[model samples]
Target: MPFVYMLQCADGSYYTGSTIDLERRLSEHQFGQGAVYTRDRRPVALVWHAEFDRIDEAFGWEKRIQGWSRAKKRLLIEGRYAELAGWSARQRACRERDG
Candidate 1:
């Protein structure tokens, strides 16, 4: 099985990734061998994860979440799916306004 996971880094940032073995991957992250982005942010904690039947699905989801805003990601981690779309729309509106 494959899984999409999120880690809350020490600096209050989120890192999203996919792995076949969550435990092994998490251990690697904890040990500073997982990702370059996480290497310096050691001691990351698993904040959220979802299992998938296929590796591609998990990877796709990981990529998608990686592009999300921190607020949207937090919404997901908090299981507040109902608020995601509204936040996403607000984000887009802010971007459009800023541009």
Candidate 2:
């Protein structure tokens, strides 16, 4: 199975990725061999993960989550699906206003 996963880094930032083997990928991240973003952060913890039947599905999900705001990602990690729409709308509104 393929999986989309999120790691909470030591600096309170998040990293999102997809992998066929979650454990091995996570181990690599821990050892500073995973991602450049995560390598500097160090000491990351698996905060969220979802399994998919296909690697492409997992990769797609990873891309989507990578674009989310920290608050939105937190809501996802906490399983607060109800608030996601509101947060997403707020984010969009902010982006539109800023631009």
Candidate 3:
């Protein structure tokens, strides 16, 4: 199975990626040998993850999640579906008002 994952960096920021080997990938991230973004932010912890049968599906969701707002991402990491909906609503309202 392919996995889509979110990592909470030591600096409290988040990173999203997809991989077929979650354990190995996470080990690399923790050891500062992962993506350049996570390399400097070593010792990251997995905050959220989902498994998919297809690499393409996992990769697509990884891309989509990376584009999300920080607040929404946090809601997802924390499994706060209610807060995510509210955040989405607020974002839409602000965009409509400004645009």
Our tally of clashes for model 1 stands at 0
- Cα lDDT of model 3 by residue, 1-99, tens digit: 899999999899999999999999999999988899999887899999999999999999999999888989988988887766646657789978999
TM-scores for the candidates? 0.89, 0.88, 0.85
Identify the runs in model 2 with alpha carbons over 4 angstroms from their true place: 89-99
Candidate 2 similarity to native, TM-score: 0.88
Candidate 1, clashing residue pairs?
A: none
Local error of candidate 1 at residue 92 (angstroms)? 4.6
Residue range 10-29, candidate 1, lDDT tens digits: 99999999999999999999
Q: Give a tens-digit lDDT track for model 2, residues 1-99.
A: 999999999999999999999999999999999999999999999999999999999999999998888989999999998878857767789978999
Instruction: Name the TM-score of candidate 1.
Output: 0.89
User: Better model by lDDT, 1 or 3?
Assistant: 1
